[model samples]
Target: MPLRVSRTPTIRHYVMTAPTFFSVEYAINPWMDPTTPVDTHRALDQWDALRRTYKELGHTVELVEPVAGLPDMVYAANGGVLVNGKAVVARFAHPQRAAESDAYAEWMSRHGYPPVRTEHVNEGQGDFLAAGRILLGGHGFRTDIRAHREIARAVGMPVVSLRLVDPRFYHLDTALTVLDDSTVAYYPPAFDAPSCHRLREVFPDALEVADADAHVLGLNAVSDGYHVVLPAAATGFAAQLRAAGFRPVGVDLSELLKGGGSVKCCTLEVHS
Candidate 1:
């Protein structure tokens, strides 16, 4: 099926109380440090600032109530991938996050997004990233490679499977950020040889982020064609975005970084 293209402005939806229960309850990825103490208040402040930044950019914002005991719930992008107002609910791999699927379904149903439930293990936007009409899917951690087929069936778009070699860049969003309909910025070393070659072939002119910037979760960013929202710490990546003709808006979410998520992790793009 041809991808849905509309003239309406893109809306960046987010969960308001994401950090209300945010903390490192378990060690899932390399970014997760159980020993690092989390400050709930700091997390809340940072998240709020990110929301405001989105609004300031003239994008509509939506919220899902944070459910208690679901600390990872704050990483809202993992809930599902929204396409043309329909949602493909994610099936989390960890038992600790299994309950999140239902919460996301309820939110989608309540907000007029019909949900497509899939049994294949996936982590929503964490592994599923859309670039124009193509869906780039990640495997080797968090999500199962078979889930790409289910997502392709659900969204009716070609899903490209990319194997992540490094655990630090476990999710596709961590390794790449879709800057625009035809452009992307990625960390080449994060993917396996075949996957890296595939990405280079697909996006031949794609920007390559430096290792220092990737280490700070720079590629885990949100872009709305013209404006790219990212972590303030990623100075090098920010410069690259500007050079690519995008306005880079940086916000500090170091508190949520404790849970191995960044700006894109806290935001979800809802298509109309």
Candidate 2:
């Protein structure tokens, strides 16, 4: 099936909330926490600022009620993938996150998004992306191999499964964002040879960022095919992207690091 992606207006509207509104164990696990008073302030500011940035760019903004106990819940976009105006609630691999898929489905319906069923067997939105083709990732997170295949069957688009090598960069978007189907920007070490081969076989000239850049999830990037988003601190990566033809829009997400999230993690891109 042809995946129709509407260019959601430069004024795309996204739903968001702050870490202060919900709690994640952001203190101990270096893999996921950025907990400190400084961290909290930064995270809250980033969340609100990101929403404002989207609005400034012409997208609509809706703030959802923060899920009471889960900090991961604040990174709402992972619970689902919005495709062709429909929302498919992701089946989280982590049992702790299973409840979120249903939550997203209900929220999407209330907001009038085209209804798409929820699945608990798939891991999370970290595994899915849609452009000319459907690309999904299988990382240490909640997304599974079965979920990848199911997404293809459900969405009627070809799916590419990225088996992950690092748990830190748990989502496909953390390292790969399609640049018009003909190009992509990603860090290589997080992926095995077969995975990189599949991507390169299709887009031989795809821009590749070094793994050193991927460590801080530096490769975690977002773009509307017009403006690309990454860490404001990652000036070098931003320069690389800018040089490659995408207008760069950097945001300070150092606060999200405490909760193991970032710009791409904070919002789900509901394509036009």
Candidate 3:
């Protein structure tokens, strides 16, 4: 049976940063290997395709100017968590991505979303995801657990903390994605026992992905209630999404995947 669509498809607003300075120079996550070569042009093309996909889906796309040294800035989802016309800018744990906070904050402020910087190390939407009336926060890698409290206070929403145990799924967006207000798709092995239990309890009908799909960052997808944009390499996930009544649009982000990010990583949803 198909999963029930609880609400009409929402026209989302997304923010993206170009891959002009994209490269695999530093080894921050398990997916990044500095020894491998990166194709800047190909990365740009892939990102543009993703942007176009969002526009074609009737969603708005906003661009953030990319900085020369911050290659990971192209993963704009890490910039901040925007909700109700307010943004909680990321306080990146690594020095390499620390400067990106200011840029994102400035953009948010200029665009009418008041920005707040967190005292605890939080990687914004990278570790925080908005689902329904609450926020799902990930920790044990890039973001601190305490940041969840700060986020809850700032966004005025309840936050459920989920601990990520797998090094490869360092970010929540990489291991899991909210398909709609009441549904999600995730890899169980990526989270701890308690976190896994919490996920199952909260999202009983959530799609459980196989290891093959998880390896390809299949869960790093973006959805606007009806259409889901995911990695083209994750064919299995595409099939599962279709079975669940979602229109899956696959895009090749092979080049951007070289930097440990894909559709959801490159696109940050601005909830207002």
Candidate 4:
């Protein structure tokens, strides 16, 4: 039998692109060790596997054209977060990825999505995730705290700010994943004391992932309420998801992990 996503009342759409120009040429996060070389060929193969996984589970997948010299462009989630047919483009903190803003903007414009250029620096869904009525955002690294307010105003949702403590968990999507409208999974160590407390207050029953899984970018996974797409190496977390009654489909994205990205990093939800 083919694995299927347990559909919610509303459908969700995601955008991703093949890793045609992925490489770890610069160091942005702790996960990126420039000394370690990345195999672009293997990265593409893994990315294709993930894309196929999404399609197999019954989800619409859109692609953003890959351009030369933009290695990080393959991490589509950083482009921007889409909500209500509007996209708030990311003003990247690093010069290396600054060019990606326009590339994502062109795609949105062509697709009838009006782009709202954010004033503060934010890395799209990489730092922002929409869960039900609220938006969860992260800062203390690539994204500025001020960007959270900008995102809230642009998207017209109440935004909750979670401060990331660990450099390896620089992005919110890296340390935390929204499993459903009410449930979430997170690596507690990635957040500070207060942020952890806040997460507990908001999601008291949030699933906690072990460090063994977190280290492999397991928390940086994608979920459509029922089906979860994550790194194949995160066996512990995969078993946990299955136990929670959600279908966990593992995809090997080890090559992209050289650049500090996994499944969620390459996926961007396009809300209608």
Candidate 5:
């Protein structure tokens, strides 16, 4: 039987990790201070805690094999997007992170997710935002212009390509998040004129997350109706979400952040 996702409904999320959770390239630069045993232990503890939290929260999780030697696989959000009840395998352009998608594809297959297709079109899942319509960002990441159309074709929804500028942010989700059908939290500077126009075309009343809060990837919030989960570090951001009429729940991502991921990266959601 084919498991289907309503165009809008509950999303079952999965978290994957290899043995690399304890041994990852937490820092982008090798020259940075190396990972300490304390950091590793902290990361491992947090990861295990995250798994339990998700299962407790009603989402499914699977810890898969680590990609051969890649240190970043632990922050698996970059691999793909589980949408329309299908696993759309992402083609990441980052030289170091491109291999992560392979594992995502394999896992989706093993789990009976929809067929995996390549979108050499984009590189970062940060750029892929699921909303009333799916929006993909490029100009900053490897999300090719054509990938937007491909995404539309794959899901039978409009995949709008939001313009981006380089060296600003790695993914759109890093700087922005769609809190609901209309509200958004983000760093305003991240969007170019055309991008903002595109957004205004639909959601004219989005909430703006502060730069200080968004800096910690706070804008990358995950929600299911009234419930939301974020990094403990983003307490203020969480409060802001509450102030904006949301029910906020949070968790610690100290270890996950150290590995370049946050709450959103840890879970793949099916928005209701």
Candidate 6:
């Protein structure tokens, strides 16, 4: 199908952490198989390419220093959800990633975004996504359902809670991508029946990706109204994005995929 592009592109600010200490030393998600070898050098190279891609596309990219022992800190999107100058810091579900919240919160403070620490388990943007005026909160895995309300109070945005069912797509960003304020693309099976129904009702025009694309973490993407940056392997989703009036820029983060993250996993949008 011919591309049907229309929406005007918007310059966005994003936060990313270098994959300096990136390694799959332990299995936290289904995609993480520590026995599998990880090319740290390749991971760093790929992450740099992703950061460069954002800059080339006219977006501001900020860096958060990666701590020595926090290998998964490279997945910066899990750090927190930043919107309207407020930083709602994450309270990680796993002990391995808990310290990362402090590192990210420190960065936020230094950057002038006062952080609001949540009492409930919330894995930052991994479980919370801002969709238009409302915030989409995902639970049933990394984030507690109770955190949804806490986040809503922190950010002053109406929160919509969605329950995840598949462990493979543990985070909300893993199974769903907010293409624009009112549009989204997702894999319905990753969510519970009610959450799937809620998504349908809220975003009737949402693109439903095939299993092949979803498995490649295609739904994990970042969009600037018109341009959508996604995994290079998600050709099916790329085609869909073009058909739906958006430009798809593919980047290979295959090395970082060893730790179960791709483009969106590494990029955290800063709404300031």
Candidates ranked, most accurate by lDDT first: 6, 3, 4, 1, 2, 5
Model 5: weakest 10-residue lDDT segment is: 2-11
Q: Would you list the rank order by TM-score, best first?
A: 6, 3, 4, 1, 2, 5
lDDT of each: 0.86, 0.66, 0.92, 0.88, 0.64, 0.92
What TM-score does each of the candidates earn? 0.94, 0.85, 0.97, 0.95, 0.82, 0.98
Clashes of 3: 0
Q: Could you tell me which residue pairs clash in candidate 3?
A: none
Model 5: how far residue 217 lies from native, Å: 1.6
Q: Compared to the true structure, candidate 2 yields what TM-score? A: 0.85
lDDT of 2: 0.66
Clashing pairs in 4: none
Evaluation by lDDT, superior candidate among 5 and 6 = 6
TM-score pick, better of 5 and 6: 6
| lDDT per residue as tens, model 5, 1-272 | 43431222244566557435445444442222344433656676776776776777677777767766676677666667666665677786656676777777787788777645764556435667777555555445546777777766766667767766534455676667766655566666777887777767767766666777766677666765445667777778888766666767677776656555677766655332
Deviation of model 5 at 75, angstroms: 2.0
Better of 1 and 2 by TM-score: 1
Write the residue-wise lDDT of candidate 6 on 119-208 in tens digits.
889999998888889999999988999989988988889999999999999999999999999999999999989999999999998999
User: Candidates 1 and 5: which is better by TM-score?
Assistant: 1
